[model samples]
Target: MEIEVRDLAGLGEWSAASALYRSVFGYVEPEFGVSPRLLAALHENSGSVIGAFDRGELVGFCYGFTAVEDGVIYHYSQAAAVAARAQGAGVGRRLKFAQAEAARRTGARTMRWTFDPYALRNAHFNFAVLGATAIRFLPDYYDDGSSDRVLVSWDLSGHVPAPSRSDEVVAPSDGRWSAPDPPDRVTLRAALIERFRAGGRLVEVTRRGEQAVYKFREADR
Candidate 1:
């Protein structure tokens, strides 16, 4: 499918972009949906909002803004959504690439975002395709009954790492990724948290059949 991506600038674009979020997220009502005014404010303030279209229909979008964390400025991507029918078609990847390019033009060097660690496909895309490193794992991040997340950071000027695997089991057969080892879940969580706090980075994620293997390396000095 031929997809067109460009900057989103007005209320008409926001209307479609908001609807795309509602559709992909399966929101039951408009009350909990993202509003066009909020998108407009983001567009006006940050100029990081972008959209993808298929024959004039908005099929996907990604937006972020520069934020200060630890006294450093970087792009924080808040959200990106693609229509269900158009998913797995590389639409999200294109949107992210566009977002990165926009960020670079504005003098930002890094982009931060979050994703569910249990989703292998997401893990593959973030680590393998986009070269993002999982720096922090937040438990109950969404409060959707143990739906935890991993905060990912992508360096705009870097390249994807070579493929590798970690001997440690990051996820079990049941797909409960947070519990790497049933007997020492608490210890594993603490270790991961401490590593990131010290600036560690997940260097590679290699899929082995039904399992996704993770490899972590020490923080770069």
Candidate 2:
């Protein structure tokens, strides 16, 4: 399928993107939904609202805004979602690269986002596919203890090296994609927290035999 990645324009496109976002994430609560008005405002205010279209249909989308911390300017990608049918077809990656290009045009050199630590697919995508590095482990990112996130930073202009084998590995005993059991979840969470606390940065997720393992290396000082 021919996929086109570009900036979304007009109310029609914005509304469609909003609907797809809610649908992909199954957001039932009003508070969890993204309004078209918010997206329009973000588009007007130097934020990117990019979409991947397949034959004029919105297949995937990503949105982010310019941010600054400690005098360093960067782009903060808040959310990205691909339609269920369009997943595994490189649409999400296309949306991200398009978003990064937009950010680069605004003079930003870094892009940051967060993902669930337990989602091994997301971890692999962020570290292995997109060359992002996990810099922080947020215990309760939403303030309601509903989610535990790993904050990742992606260099917009640099070519990051592929991850190498590391001595530190976090592997689940059960070989599950996620830690569903409370005990397993707690153990994995604590291990990741300790690694991040000691200046470790997650660089890769690899498979050793039948189990997936996360690899970390010391962050550059």
- Measured by lDDT, the strongest candidate is 2
1-221 in candidate 2: lDDT tens per residue?
78999999899999999999999999998899888998999999989999999999998989999999999989999999999999999998999999999899888999999998777778778888999989999999999876899999999988665555354655553444655678877887888899999888888776676556778887775
Residue 116, model 2: lDDT of 85
* TM accuracy, model 1: 0.84
Q: Report clash pairs, candidate 2.
A: none
Off by over 4 Å in 2: 161-166, 173-176
* lDDT value, residue 31 of candidate 1: 85
Cα TM-score per model: 0.84, 0.93
- Which parts of model 1 have CA positions greater than 4 angstroms off? 29-31, 159-167, 174-199
